[model samples]
Target: MTTDSLDLFADQPPTPPAPPDDAGAEAGDDGTLALDRYAERAYLAYAMSVVKSRALPQVEDGLKPVQRRILYAMSEMRLSSSAKHVKSARVVGDVIGKYHPHGDSSVYDAMVRVAQDFSLRYPLVDGQGNFGSRDGDSAAAMRYTECRLTPIAELLLAEIDRGTVDFIPNYDGAFEEPQLMPARLPFVLLNGASGIAVGMATEIPPHNMREVAEATCHLIRHPDAGLDDILAMLPAPDFPGGGQLISSPEAIRDAYASGRGSLRLRARWRIEELARAQWRVIVEELPHGV
Candidate 1:
């Protein structure tokens, strides 16, 4: 009899196993992880990092990580209002090298914003060169600009070493920085803050220092004071641009009570007659965000 016929199919290798549902992910020692679960965890970690380390301003100091770092770096260099101003590049270098460990442009941009009068109700940095303009002009390069801390900034840093606040290690653990500046007053209310983080945001408009102080005093005297009583001392936001708020009193009251509301703002402008029959408009002040 003839030998059993060879089967070509029998010699063929078995089909390779199918890939996991998450084709992009590689197998780990633990087990296969769903793509969605991995993404969710990554997103959550990134969001928390931004909220805590970069985006939001601390309620205690009313300064974001970058801003606080710049101020602290300046203070360490003794760049006070009365001190001789130094090249902004120098400050930026120190900040990146010692504390912030970020891009030079970002650090310089934050410094410029702190010096811009139009950007803050009370500017915290004293810039000697073109910092910026309300018309959207950018500041000069760091090498060309010089800066120092404003007198008011001293209010935030003066007691830093008097045991008023806690200090923590910097990024490389080579230096120490304050956890939060010991501001005498609520700088958050005075300068106002606007930042959008991963899931939450803030849009606090600046208020008059006198009004805030009076309201604070009222609260201290009458701990149970009603919102109406507080409002009497601090009626509304006092923007640096000096625009008129057209929102009704009722609307303002409701906003404060509910912690959510919008205010209508009107720019202050006037007409100036030109040489020709045409007249030009001169804007005296702009709305808060403008």
Candidate 2:
């Protein structure tokens, strides 16, 4: 015999097995399954939960679950535009202890971001302390900060008092929170959103309220308007911070049409002529979310 014949299977296991009988088929019918199936189902559940309830913002209000909860908690405290700013710690505490149940730091961070003028195109919270910096500095401790809702924020919460949206019990069932804000406008497109979830991601740029309104009005008037026509009305993003969009109008239109592509933006600056022939370049507006 050759040396290959001495192999374990070669020595005694050359016979072909018969096809699976009825009993063999029945064996797989039990609740047990391949390990991958169990893992797949478990992972799907987690992904869906993250995508729907945590990561992505709701299209109707343009707010993520945490953001919505923060706003709801602030509204409950009557932190309206006309009201006094409450301590950031109190808001974080209430959010963690009630609706969010995540952690104080995260909740405070979200609130701080909402209050930051350099962050949100339309700031929701009006802060009264060292919230943060544009150069990537961290905000002060929550205890040192105070905040209340801005006038624009009131638009999202106005109808809540009138029962425009239904309230569901908080995490512990001790309180109630709105299912979704009854937004008077398309805040999602107005503010924009970016998030990464399991198997998916989204990054939408902010737009000027007036441009958005004009496009929206056109759509309302001519319901059959195509994406190109809409682009004609609002050619490119109008950052509130006022930057130059380097991307051509055609590129912007393509992005909007295909629901993908990047819009290049450059900060706008102006040269100031001073006395004695001295000149200084001053940055006027930065591309928001850059």
Candidate 3:
């Protein structure tokens, strides 16, 4: 057997077989009912593993592993500031091989989503060739698409080499991993998040960068300001795709006061006239599931 397999077996302890189908098992000495504690413990361990490793976002970094890998892969490709674009296939291969260690299709899908301006209020990717659209169209094949990082991404990744964050050994100890991201902006609010876990979940809405920043500054200056004061600075969520926040004025006030609530959003459309034709296009829309 391989060394790794031997090690795995060595770490495991043998379990006792259960009583035969017709046999009545005796209770433990302490009068406790017989139970498969080992199995229960194993199941609980697996659940906690999934929750810690997948569902919950790391508050320090404001990103999951896949998201971090995508940004780093873009930086490694030298696609930050240069006009030269790399094929999406190249990016996918790099991320899968060097960082994400996941299927190429999923990595490519995330890449396209990050590039779509309509999906993100501030897209972190600058893509060429069809990267998909807000109407739920699939992006072109990796070979047909080209990509690079946007200026905002550049700012986020720049701190990686500056020793501002921590790095540790990866799962296999064959590579290093970033413990957290030194994000210049509050990206959690900028892009928002939605994730599910055992007995828990989170749903956050995207907000305008300018408005959020202004509100943050105001809060800093007047630490004791009430919810109304903060709401005065940030009237409502301003989406990049130019949409109206449809919640009642009172609803917004309540949300800010309670620190939680849902907001309604609607798309904004505009009509354009050409020399021989007229066209209607949606200029803006609220973030999905707002």
Candidate 4:
């Protein structure tokens, strides 16, 4: 052989193969477990819980779980529009103890929202005291406030005893709650809803009662009527706050057709003429949710 040169600096030789892995031992290690499968299942379960049981409102009744519980509890307590208003705390207690097994504040908040005219197109709870304000005021303590369901709410609960909806057992199986309310109107479109859930969300704008009623009647008369016919009766959203919907006709029509669109709403204002050729802008109405 020719004169061979010894390489002084070189990588170490590869180590011999380790002993064969024990299948049982490998399985015992957390690293080898099917983590992705378990994680996926857990994520899906939590997502469904948020979507179906909590965040989103049911299309049939337009009420979230908490809202539905509040209404049903009030109905059970005979807190009708004609009846005298009861302390909000009492209703909250009934709701928590019977139908909803949640915190007192959350239930009370939902009840307050149902009462606030600025929040709902049609106030469901006829609140006697300070429920809240459009200017960002928190509602008074539940103990201080009094509330009874409004006449509009009566429509939702009137047919409960007549088997208009199915009932299911409450959290502890101590009570039964209706699956959905027997709504006389399509409350989903009437009051509108905005909710965020797993991978999806909904933002339905409130419509005028008369327009919605007319559209409902039209649909009932002609089940297969086109969107244009329906649009003629229900032209655009009518928010609780009276403001101008400045969106063009084409945009409005597109929104109705595609089921996804944005609306441009501006506060109603007018220029007031003052002395010495001075003028000032006075805002009459604000956009909804402002």
Candidate 5:
């Protein structure tokens, strides 16, 4: 009975070969890494990519990678203010082919948002067709649209050729791209930013240009001045699509100081009196990101 059972076992397949050793472990006997360590490294890499390459705008330039790439590609095409608008599809194609190396829709969406007046305090692109609406309507397809850089955008790219900023290799390394725009103004604070990265997110509200300039000059003059001095000049955020700030001045100061706080924004409306007894509330502006 033992011999028959042993023969049956021999006919069965030999235990599958032990799983191959990991590349690092096989390449160097002493280089073996635990599974947890490997997972930590991988996750850290993904988080860095999301934070640096995809989500956050460079504070200096106020432009995300995709937004910057689209503008750069358009500049390459000589789609400046004076130049006639070109099919948005052409710009999207150039971006995806040359630098971005992503889906066409993503590039186009980024471009569209840059052109939106209600979105940016100062729009970067001048689009010739239905870019979108504040009512939450989607823009027309890229093929049906045309665009060129606005005058303000030219300011960002003005000294790009003169090497005002560093250059980095593109996704495929076939070409190079700017690390950030050579912005003449502090567009980062001017335009504001909102992004969600791996561990951190940002939500900066747009500000009035005049107030921003004054505050900047004030800082230049009084480097040791406290937040009150800045707040005296800047007061509170002034969004492009004007809205009323219900947050008190003290609360605003606290938010700016602590790097975390929410602003209470109310829609700006006006009363249009049709008659002595009848009136209508006309909403002139909506809260940011409404």
Candidate 6:
């Protein structure tokens, strides 16, 4: 056939396929085939998204993106050191508007966690206003709250920001993330952690900063020391909120040995009679997440 004739046939448009009669398709007798394989793939993809993006820590940066953004935003705001305190709302707005792109609530929650003394043995932020108390009360509204970076935060976050730690692009490639918190102290041990993932979880208790530092120093001195030696040096969780760790001695030993366990914490409170027949109950210390 001639090239022109062949071209006419090749260029001919095929008829469009008929659309499905109903939005819902027929299901198999077992109702398995009706399930969208793509849906399962999509669900798994979304779960991994949460796990990778929100739940788990990336090897590159010891902190998740929210934490990275908080530190970075605090750095940019100059709230680290030698700067006036900024409103918690302002910090929250800045974090949400600039880096996190998540809900303001999540950002604020992270900010509050960093500021709360009971949460971190060495609080990263020096917070003002009703950043709540050790008595398990909710903090004042973001509008009513104020905060500034603490000296410890300055030491850990600011010192490291000055070209000490590596920075990477955030999830959207819009902001930078720290490779790791260049904390002078072993913050993870000092503050401890509690998180839940898909199939795994972590629950650690707070330790005294000074004591943990001493233990770390001891470990550095004696690299070959066993867990017993470390536990002997750093016994029990000395929470900032001053609550007693209710774990038995053996339980404490097992926790220190395996580096995991449930820790029962209580708030330390004292009562005083105020003038005019009023009683004032003051909480001196609290457990983590109180």
For each candidate in turn, the TM-score is: 0.84, 0.86, 0.75, 0.86, 0.86, 0.71
Error of 2 at 182 (Å): 0.1
Which of 3 and 5 is the better model by lDDT?
Answer: 5
Per-residue lDDT of model 1, residues 1-290, tens digit only = 01122222111222333443554465466776676766766666655666667766888878998899999999999999899999999999999999987679878888998899898999999999999888889999999999999999998898798899999999879899988999988898899887666676667778899999898888889999999999998999888879999999999998888777788999999999988698999999899768
Model 2 residue 257 CA deviation (Å) reads 0.8
Q: Write the per-residue lDDT of candidate 5 for residues 1-290, one digit (tens) a residue.
A: 00011111011222233333353653345766676756666665656666677777888888998899999999999999999999999999999998977778779888999999899999999999999998899999999999999998988999799868899998778999998889877888888887766666777878888898898888889899998888888898877788889998888888888877878998988899896699999998898778
Return the top candidate by TM-score. Answer: 5
Candidate with better TM-score, 1 vs 2: 2
- Give candidate 2 misplaced runs (Cα > 4 Å): 1-27, 274-278
Report the C-alpha lDDT of model 2 over 132-195, residue by residue, as the tens digit.
8887888999888899999999888887878798889987899888889999888888888777
**lDDT (10s digit) by residue, model 6, range 1-290:** 00111111111122232333331345456644334654555455544545555654443333555766787788888886568888888988888777767778777777788788767777777778888765668888889888877777765674664788887776578777666766666666666655544444455556777778889899889999887788787888876657767778898787666655556777778899999999988987656555
Name the better of 2 and 5 by TM-score.
Answer: 5
Q: Model 3, range 1-290, lDDT digits (tens) per residue?
A: 00111111111122333433322344466745445754555555654544455554565545656677788877767887565888989989988777766578768877887788777778888899998766677888999999888988865787687799888776567777676678877776777655555445555567778877887788789899877787777777655576677899998777766667777777666777667676667565545633
Q: Write the residue-wise lDDT of candidate 4 on 64-104 in tens digits.
A: 88899999999999999899989999999999899877779
Q: Candidate 6 clashing pairs? A: 241-285, 241-286
Task: Kindly give the stretch of ten consecutive residues in candidate 2 with the minimal lDDT sum.
Answer: 1-10
Which pairs clash (backbone N, Cα, C closer than 3 Å) in model 3?
Answer: 241-284
| Every candidate's lDDT | 0.83, 0.78, 0.69, 0.82, 0.82, 0.67
Highest lDDT against the true fold, candidate: 1
Instruction: Name the lDDT of candidate 5.
Output: 0.82
Candidate 4 RMSD computed on C-alpha atoms after optimal superposition onto the true structure: 15.6
TM-score, cand. 5 vs. native: 0.86
